[model samples]
Target chain A: MVDHVGLLSAFGLIDAGYRQAVQVMEEGGLDGSTSDPDFLVATGSEELRADIPVLRHDGKLNPNGRHMAQQPIELILLKQWASYLALPVWLIDDSGNLLYYNEPAEALLGVRFEEAGEINADQLAEHFHTTRLDGKPYPNAELPIVVALVGRVPSHDTVRVRGLDGVWRILAITAFPVEGQGGRHLGAVAMFWETHDS
Target chain B: MKVTLWGTRGSLASGGPDTVQYGGDTAAVELRGPAGEFVVLDAGSGIRPIGEQTPSGTKRVDILLTHLHMDHIQGLGFFSPLFDPEIEVHVWGPGSTTLGLRERLTRYLSPPLFPVMLRDLPDVTLHEIRPPASFALGSLTVRAELITHPGPTMGYRIESPECVLAYLPDHEPALGVAEFPDVPDWTSGFELAHGVDVLIHDAQYTDDEYKSRVGWGHSTFDHALAFAALASVKQLVTFHHDPGHSDEMLDRAMAEMSESHDLEFELVPGRVGLTTCVD
Candidate 1:
């Protein structure tokens, strides 16, 4: 079995809540009268084994490991496997800062993960030239990503944005808040598909 | 449905001469059902008045509390209906994962906080409720949505065949760093109050007070008015008057306000005993 301690800390999942959750995971599980079961571990405790080599490789590739420490364990799992998905994935912390995006998402943003270290929610909107799907005015606060982070509820909306190629892409996005135990918000993730005119 | 503003003062109870006109009870409102069923909102000090007004033969009533803040629930013990065996009051409120509504209410309803225990109230049934859920309250379709607040807070929309009335007694619709994890954005408030005939909302601050008190989970009169206008609600009742605000101060908040030519809607500062019919 992987050393849960080394794996969690190595991934830079270093928030106080995450640490407290790990402590519970070590002592026992909340299913059996665990004290102060604050956070829920999205990933199981089985780690360090050669079978789960992807997490190890991702930890090595994490440019923002120091920053990832602030994210919840569930978010860490998203960071690890989100890039592998065929769909473009965008992740933001509970505070609504752009934490990371998959390669496909980066291609859409026309920026790179390494090049753009951290961007606030507002700055990302300005960079993308986001607008309402209806071609009407859209407020920064009402962005699907912002709604997901602020409302802590799953939201789906279509937005028109000027992509890097100077083409207006109509993207249908569904965003849901990442939460730990007791409904504590971890962050939010957005999955999107760009509709093209044939 | 007929609505009565039994308690309008916000934060704390202040019963004095200055508050006589608006009355100094904290958040409680009662909606007399069209078919004689009882539906009440919150249990603040205003519940005492409801308990007194309730007739003994009233068989069933549902109390949907917005949250468990002290000011919102301090009058529960004083509410006499819980002691009567004849009335079956079903209490519903938002609950955390670790605690249900009844368990969390023990914080104030138990020995240390009050003499009576929830267990003693055989007539009262506490149900742990979450929002984004809708349930039928007799003929009225009641919808509850999680709103922006410090704890697990909720706002409600009550609809009848005749008209729709949305009540958000304790809410801060403005966006800021939220304390709770899943608290919805300000748009949720607009959605709840949208297209309703009467929107009774928290107007607990002035524009000046709201500056320093931003993110405190309360709204100013301007915020309340703006929401009522945006939602296109027919009438707005500025509720949850600040405890420090006297009847005179409340009068000025509404008296100075006028309906713009572009936006025509009736605005009234809420007062205890003022009844508004949802028609």
Candidate 2:
């Protein structure tokens, strides 16, 4: 073990130079720098959320096949269907974990689905800061999406949520449970559209 | 601790004259602890031979499956102990949200696919394991974690009194990474493999082949070497040989790879019936 550790430290110097050479070649030998003005502006700005993880804004790697491989086929299809629809849609698994939300939904959520990544049911409920129309904190169990997820039933309601940008919006949401051919409850889908600002 | 590779061929089992050197069988491995504890990893077609070799005195055997890929579990029905009423068989595997291990295994083990049902095998127990699960098998301590694979796959860390071994037969740590081998803590199977005595990892594709096969749940040799270096593993057993690669091609590939990279650790090509001991 001691010998291996010693060898690892010695190899670090060679490995670093090797990787740098590979990177230089991969970047077309341009010194690994970008001269794009848009990139410079994006990096120079302060509006970019410092807390958010870096995502490839182009949505190329967002929700790739590997990320969806373990999900039920029904849920996978629903995610695909949501991706094409202009309406905002949120897909949650049987455990009510937030699997994904479409681009339109991303706009309303004030964060890209890639940026938020996958959040558990509990964390998601808290992340959205959902409340009833009466200005009271809404129980997660009673929320339309959670109700659909838990009961395998359709649910609809109007609720207020604080987006990631700290803007509160009143939205109308309809959620329905998704079931596969063998009576397996795959997951639930929630479609929402903004009605007004809260 | 003794680690034996019963199978190394990936994707499919291709037994022919060309593959005799590497032994064409899908992923099945046996790890024996010093205290007579027996553990089998995967039930690929290679497991048929392992079942034929099982000692009669062995009362219990545990099979830890990484995932339910057909290539990984196709030999479950052929495993001899599952049919023996005297021997206890325990199968552990990852489960998805809608289905548990038993339910998932039932899909392949029942009816039209196979003549017998999973339940028909007396004394066979199926345990649904979630990642980050730890358990003890006699003298061996095993830890399982979800890895970057297409399905609900797991990589295992087996620690015996004498040594530690990591098995990640199918993985793609560079799937979405801008740059791979970023850090030991950030890599997929690094946690299980870090500083282990032996790291049996996926090296099913050449870097050229991997260019077109990204996100296919396997690693290139370059990625494997980088990962081994980052983890500081003492011995790296390059596993999961591509079914298309014959002995000659594999030898040429390895020779080229050796010339290109400055390796710091012992590199061994995984092969059937090859046993390495840690004491």
- Across B1-279, the per-residue lDDT of candidate 2 in tens digits comes to 998998899989999988887779999998889998888999999898889999988899999999999889998999999999889998988777567677899999999999999989999987766555567779887777677778788888888868989999998877766577653433577667777889999999988899899879899989898988887888889889999999889888778777888888888878788887557
Candidate 2 residue runs with Cα over 4 Å from true position: A1-198
Q: How much does each candidate deviate from the true structure in C-alpha RMSD?
A: 15.7, 18.0
Give the DockQ of candidate 2: 0.03
What's the distance in Å from true for residue A106, model 2?
Answer: 15
* Per-residue error (Å), model 1, residue B208: 1.0
Worst window of 10 by summed lDDT in candidate 2 chain B: B178-187
Q: lDDT of each structure?
A: 0.70, 0.75
Report, to 2 decimal places, the DockQ of model 1. Answer: 0.05
Question: Which candidate should be chosen as best, given lDDT against the real structure?
Answer: 2
State residue B172's C-alpha deviation in candidate 1, in Å: 1.2
Which 10-residue window of candidate 1 chain B scores lowest in summed lDDT? Answer: B177-186
